[model samples]
Target chain A: MEKKQSKLSIVTNGLLHENPNLRLVLGTCPTLAITTSVFNSIGMGLAATFVLIFSNMAISACRKIIPDKVRIPAFITIIAGFVTVVMMLVQAFVQPLYQALGVYLPLIVVNCIILGRAEMFASKNGVLDSALDGLGMGIGFTLTLTAMGFIRELLGAGTLFGIQILPDAVEPMAILASPPGGFFVFGVLMALAIMLDEKQGRKVDADPEKIGCAGCPNSKNCHGEGGCE
Target chain B: MLVKSSPHIRDNSSTQKIMLDVILALCPAILASAIIFGLRALLVIAVTVVSCVVFEYLYCRLMKKPNPIADLSAVVTGILLAFNLPSTLPLWMAVIGAFVSIVIAKQLFGGLGHNFANPAIVGRIVLAVSFAGRMTAYAYPEVTNGVAALAGATPLVATRNADLPLLTLFLGTHGGVLGETCAAALLLGGIWLVVRRVISPVIPVTYLATVAVISLLAGQEPLVQLLSGGLMLGAIFMATDYVTSPYTLTGKLVYGLGLGIITCAIRFWATSAEGVSYAILLMNLLVPYINDLTRQKPLGGGKRK
Candidate 1:
């Protein structure tokens, strides 16, 4: 059905238009900490995306049976199961990343991205749509995490995934690895995201009251709408 | 018939009134430092205050705007900024800090509540980074039987690594800024502010708790961390700056917790033994966001994160 196809669109749109990490700003701690290296970023991103998809699928399947009173608890329990699985697998196989993401690995349960998608999307959507939504959001988070990691590692350590980018003469700012630097980097990136959104005619926060030049008689009443005159 | 508004009550509080109380509250610390550190401390405080007021006045005049110096907020910033610096810092550097605080941090950012970080802390950090030698240059006053300590590592530096006597740190025997040496004095000022309702305990108390818990975990003496360096001054005064801190009680608690956690981490593990100023500045930067996130809507209002 056309309705079903559009429903699927909602799931896929999150990959860029409504990305959980980049666009919506969910789960920032992992974005800041694990993004110190590209490898770690990919690892953390894939891990989080896996959790998000599974949690969304489970939450979607259980939506009808879940009581409104305890929906949050139910969703959290489902998300926690996937997060635990991710943690065990990462520790067993990816030992370096496991160590780098200490405490944050367990903290995935508190990540707003998975929980937000589960509550906002999976709670109302069908199983297939929910799974796609999870996949889209998960990949979006992964891409952002990888980008952040690439940047921090490239500048802070002068290497991208252990490859030297900058010369040895250039000294990296020690603060880049610290928490304050993490916040600064994240703030700048968010500002950049907002600027990019504007450039692409997304109009995420457009005011409906304002009239464009098309509605004006002489084009003098432009209403600052892209200087249409 | 005139339509009456739903709410008719108006409180006695204003931004100017709160800023005035802050100025008055810092007086005891300023006077105590002047008495203990002698003419130099008084000179430094006077120059810092006058320069801040002048800079603020001239900035507004040049910009063709109404002057904000009448409210004495610049005076409070000057006094607080002086308190953070070593008494031995050259008067010119202190003046530069005043200019940075008022012109760059305050006015350039649209004044008062507009700044993302505390102006004084930013000024201090600027001096700390740019003129580390002068900023860290401390001079112990001539007291009975003991030689005056010169510019060197602070008690926090010593305490960060080894066990320091709580009593020595509690009193003003350690090496730090003139105002920061005595925990009792800072506490007295904090208590006065609280008694006068100049500042709420939400920030100071929460920030202290965060630092205490983190330091305890990091194998540092909790009491020593509390008493050493600028922790008390930062918690009591700088962190509680009305314009740069969270408005709601829960938001303040969260901000304070973040400050304390970061401060303790820096003190115990990072290169700097003192992290209070940096931590407070960082939290001050987050205040607006916290206010936004924790903004409680009117009863039965719209809900969003």
Candidate 2:
């Protein structure tokens, strides 16, 4: 009963407050690549989410057994196990999506969001909380990618998920569907997200720390007592 | 009048006055663009200018900041962006260029003084990259000899490949962007800006000198290289932007030299026709580091060992 009150906040935090794509800005490699279409965005998001939940649960369950010294390797091994499962499931079921995602599906094993949460939240939290965090963050990533894909596809290709959206007169900007197009959409979306936060008297500062901390060897170690946020 | 309540110093120039001076200085080139490219070019300029000012104002309103269109900076950016575009470019595309200039490059980076790079250059590059086919479709004015040669290609490419005469290239009787064709007019406008003291001669002089010397050494006619494309306009205007270029003279020299070298490499050997825009953009990004490297010592001298 006591944990239930904070449960809602944790999920919401992943959805809005600490969204992996917009707020956390993790898993951007996949986001930029997969956001050309709504289907790819949803597929990638769900696949990553599935991997996240299981990995988080697995990591949480073994948190005590895994030593602090080699926890990173252990976490990777566990996450890789789930990612392999996801790759197999997608290949067997949705062959087209598997083909579309290509090497990226296998590349999901190294996604920062999964590895990041494993280090930050799941390792320190209970199974239920970890699962919810995965779900919320996954949904947030899904929505962001879908929105970007929808805009890019509509403007760049004049179609949405292979359906014609714009009329023939409007010559779509094909660049929006390319890699640079992905960046433009991602930038516009990020700006809008920051602006919305500002409207509520809170600012979303794109501090370099969040992204920089991921690859840092001393991420776990604070400068002194409480580490850099 | 509005004097401060203490020991104070002041300068007569403000953002508005500087912007106004730039606009005045740009008039000669603007007139030349109209004369050379025709009335359609004027339409592009008007559309871009209005859209840029409106976008700036709307952005300010949405962000709940005071209106910034009064500064006339947007107007200057508009003219510069229009100057980069071909006369044949669609008006809606010009509007897109304005949005990119004011909103993405200007407002999103917290406006004017805080913007990372020159907004006009970014806007023009974005448009160029996004619509390469449209952006490069330079509309040639009625020139007798050049009519058979590239009816729609920019002169930089044609000059390299085709047997285009240096005289024709010098006299601006070829297809190119609005400001690039008229070397004489750009020189006049650049001289006016220099005389007005709105900018120092450091960036433009160094940039042009580097390009000329390198071009001569590389066995290309320096005057032909100088007069052919947007080199004069860009070296004069875009490279000398207040908020983006380096502050120290040493920093400005390095930045200008870098730009010149890049521009020469791209034009002589690379695939692209004109590299002035990209050269300036890249150098603009390096301004902070250049400033640090060329930072002036204190008047009394306190240097780090």
Q: Could you tell me the TM-score of chain B in model 1?
A: 0.92
Steric clash count of candidate 2: 0
**Per-residue C-alpha lDDT of model 2 across residues A1-229, encoded as one tens digit per residue:** 2234388777876766567777667889988997788778788888998998899989988998999999999999999999899999999999999998998888888898898889887888888988887887778877888898889888887888889989987767767888977987888888777677667675445655664654432244232334645
Query: Evaluated with TM-score, which candidate comes out highest?
Result: 2
Candidate 1 fraction of reference contacts recovered: 0.00
Index of the highest-DockQ prediction: 2
Cα deviation at A101, candidate 1, in Å, is: 36
**What would the per-residue lDDT of candidate 1 be over residues A85-199, giving only the tens digit for each residue?**
9999999999998998888888899899888888767887888888888888888888888777777787667888788888976544444555655765676566566557767
In angstroms, the error of model 2 at A67 is: 1.9
